[model samples]
Target: MKRLYQTVPTGCDWAVEAQGLVKTFGDHRAVDGVHLKVRTGTIYAVLGPNGAGKTTTIRMLTTLLRPDDGSARIFGYDVVKESHIVRQLIGVTGQYASVDESLSAIENLVIFSRLLGMGRKEARQRAEELLEEFSLTEAANRPLKNFSGGMRRRLDLAASLIAQPPLIFLDEPTTGLDPRTRNQMWETIRKLVNHGSTVLLTTQYLQEADELADRIAVIDRGKVVAEGTADELKASVGNSSLQLKIQHSYDMERARQIVEQVLKVRSNTSTETGRITAPMTEADRVTDLLIALREAGIHLAELSVQKPTLDEVFLTITGHGVKKDTAVDSSSAVEEVRV
Candidate 1:
């Protein structure tokens, strides 16, 4: 009974690379000329709204789907040409849990271990270890049908790691979990990277990307629109905003005039509340605006500076919010209306 351990060298450099990767379905291009470079042993988050081609990109990289054009390499093996070798070095957790509902938590993991070529004893041992690590030890023998959503997600993640592949692709891994469970999952992901596993995650949650990603790539219209650290993207979209709430609605115009005079730019005035907001690109600009407001005798009931959010960055780049449909195939990316 030989133990099967992945012998591929860990932590060399970029664990996943996509060069001009393109995937099209019918007349629609799901992934168009996308390029990504993810460093080894790091978490790189791909963020966008639904149907942003994130899943398509992940499929091509994992060799689950073939690209119409270009190439994607995982651990230096071509995704299309060397798919078998690539598959051996990577693990994938798609949008839904792929575990067998009839099997107990431990049974599910053991099955994955066996599939990975581990002997029976080794498979059972690995399953038990993972069950404990993911805090599923108490429910080790419970069938997946009896498990909660969070529990099932943890088991799904554990099974992917049964082979301890160097690269892991997580597509919306925390989609349906509660806040506490989502935090727990974040901790688990952090632990994996600390242990030298490189993770490529696709998620619509901006905060998740901000918290976990070493770098984030924003895909819109089957293209990479922005790629940078959270702060970099925020800065690229420009500065924090100084929002002023006037005591009286009539004072809104006054506040706007003062802000515009001080900031030398047109202030964004809210029509509903009469609040005026000016973009503050520099820390000094905040002070300058405050001083100017005081000198102008413009009194603000409330004033606060807010750092640019990822949503703002997305809006700035695409001329619409990430929630909007700006993709090449607009109909495919549109949010489904719930009855």
Candidate 2:
């Protein structure tokens, strides 16, 4: 099976490199000629809707499945020919939390550390260190069944880091968590990168990618439709809008009128958000709008220049919004891999 994708090797400084990667299942081309070059010690995010070939791409790069075409390298080692070496350099946290339901947090980390060839005493020490790092020291002795969602996630992350691999693959690590827990996980990921780990993250949440990714690649129908930093991608949309919120409801109509008269373009008002949004045709439109509004005595609660959202970007790329129902879970994705 390994021989299928194994080919001539290449050299690279990237923490991860894949070129023209392809995968198929019977008639389905789950992954289609995807290419990715992730810089070392930074976070790269892959975001797409359900069944968008995200999981299949991850499986190929992780050496869990042979690609139908193309090649991938991990830290300059070919994923296929040097799979053992590749695996040695990386750790994976799947979409779902993988900690043992019955094991205590400390026990889980200890076992993982021991498996990474630590001695009993060394394992114990490492376990304690990780427990503190993840802020789970208080629950270290409690069975994981009693742990909250956030604690379990942190523990799962700690276990995956037992070997301190240089590169980590996280597939939707924040799925199914509340906003607070999700934020905590985001911080943990940032801390990992700060301490010198390169992360390749796949997620359905646009905001997650916006907040955490140093670079984002959007995949659809197994193709990379776009790739750039959040700001770069937004700027690529090629238009900015003057966004204004008036302090009083009575000022909405006046504010709208002032914006339309200044920009010479129709403005929209959202009753829900009380915002007047209009596209800016000139470079100084927002500034012009501000001065005009102030002259007219329209006090604003908020004013800013706005670009298209990641959500809007995705819609433009894929011709639809993300369908959470179409999202393939990790376990199901793994099971669908063809040899």
Candidate 3:
């Protein structure tokens, strides 16, 4: 694989840029010619399935892994040639908590501050500020080993801020968190961007990207399949779907046949729920479906036309559900490597 990094256009202001990035491990090409542009002070999310090279792209951008071909830049600093400078301007939070279990919440942050070259008094003050900001002030003195998963995650994020980097890379920041805690983390990320910090997030949760990202890129098999705003991507797949809920389970197959034969379009049927979903390409399809169902003596309990979702767009592009693959669970740790 060969990766190339190009500078942003003369007038363009991008916090991150990649062009023709390629990475290979043995015969496996992990990242293939991925071109990305992330503006300053915005959240850019990379979304894909488990083995889709989302993590590999992040590693290349953060300067953790050298691409076999292509180039990447962080704030105009070359990820390969000027990696030290790039590292200085970025912070990263991996999937799992990276805090030292033996260290207290405050101690962990202080350690990072010290490593960043803050004086002892300055480091202590920075630690206190971050602990309070992350709502871990009350647990500052307690060891991280005693904290809940959410608390530990918060502490890990807070530690990443010790250096006050302008760019942050968050890899599955909310994975394994409860709904409430996940929302809280989302709020934190929003707050960071509000203060002019840029964030690049990679997540499996479509809802997370929909809520937090200013732009999204969907990658698969080491290549980018689609890139746009949520609504834009949804629109790419074309037309809404009319889902019909038949009165009886036995009527589902019959309804599907009618929809396919009459509408001249493929109909998707759910065996468990007795629902038939067909793409609504024409305005009269809904009316036609209802009339055909009635003529066939099939009672439809419910009917709805729904626009495509981000999940649907992902599925259409990848030929698979956006759900994570369980076989890659053990390799997720390897995916966390970042600058």
Candidate 4:
């Protein structure tokens, strides 16, 4: 297949690169030998379940936590030796809202701008422009304590972009948001890329990574177990399958029997979707199934080919579904960790 974007033609093309990155706390290895090569002007997702060492990796890449081993560069600057330069080029935001509750929306943005070395007039102008861009101008003067979760999330992102950094690190920025709000956050991330920014995202929401990331690295047990585009990862797990909705509950048994005999593989059905799925191949075709079912006097409500999902890919690679945890001190630990 044709490549989607141009490969890095020169040494300066990468936005972030690392090799053999390892971090340990006493006997525990939070991040073990993690590596990455993120391109310029695209979204790269580090996808993993909690306690999978995602936050520890971000800390090393952003120069917040010193790595016990390995090294990394951000747009040609060393994360450790040249951390000051790295800081100037990148923005980091995490799960928690970082704005002061007592401050107004405009006030929060202006403060960030000021901290970034903007003069009084410049800071005010930048804050106003960002408030407008993020669609928060209507509530710019309202205290942050009154802002909704979505509004506060947007404001936090705006603050991170105050200096217009070339690269941004978003550590699960959409966790705990309503569907509409999550979509809004996704749009905001896309807008950042459209404006010539490179983003490195860490997320457990498989769908979020599937939607936003141009490429993905699935981390399990503090190391990258898989890396590719969403489709590539999904394709790696298994083949596309045929999904059928039986017209009646009684038809399910007959359909399953016909499908098994035709495909020579076991079939699985779900009570929730009222669907049965089996691997799709030329030998197990819709026409053949329909013909066989017609002779057997069985009917199906729907039939379609379905590809594997990222969630399925995760379970396949990791051997289990992701277990949720909120304990900050644990291996999963991610909540606005800063530099």
Candidate with the greatest TM-score versus the true structure = 1
Best by lDDT: 1
Give the per-residue lDDT digits (tens) of candidate 2, residues 214-287: 98888888987777676555443325666788888888998888877877765668867888776565867677
lDDT of 1 by residue, 101-202 (tens): 998998888888998888888899999999999999999997778899999899899988988888999999999899999999999899999998899999
Q: Judging by TM-score, tell me the better candidate of 1 and 3.
A: 1
Mark the regions of model 2 whose C-alpha exceeds 4 Å error after superposition. Answer: 1-12, 238-307, 318-339
1-339, model 4: which lDDT tens digit per residue?
221122223457789988779999999999998878888999999999888999899989999999999889898889999999888888898668878999999988887888788888888999999999989999999998888888988998998888778889998888788999899889999998998889999998767898999988888778877777776565444456678898888777778889867765456677667788765535336677779888998877888887655445555555432222211122221111111
| Whole-model alpha-carbon lDDT for candidate 3 | 0.77
Q: Rate the local accuracy (lDDT) of all candidates.
A: 0.79, 0.77, 0.77, 0.78
**Lowest summed lDDT over 10 consecutive residues: which window, candidate 2?**
1-10
Tell me which residue pairs clash in candidate 3. Answer: 2-69, 2-70, 3-69, 3-70, 3-71, 4-70, 4-71, 5-71
- Candidate 3: C-alpha RMSD to true structure equals 8.3
Q: For each candidate, give its TM-score against the true structure.
A: 0.82, 0.71, 0.80, 0.74
Which digits, one per residue and each the tens of the lDDT, describe model 3 over residues 1-339? 111122223453788988879999889999988878888879989888788898888888888899899888888889999998788888888777888999898888888888778888888998999988889899999987789989988988998777777889998888889999999999999999998788999988767888999988877789877677665554444357677888988777788889877766555677888777665657676777778889999998888887755445555545442223321321232232111
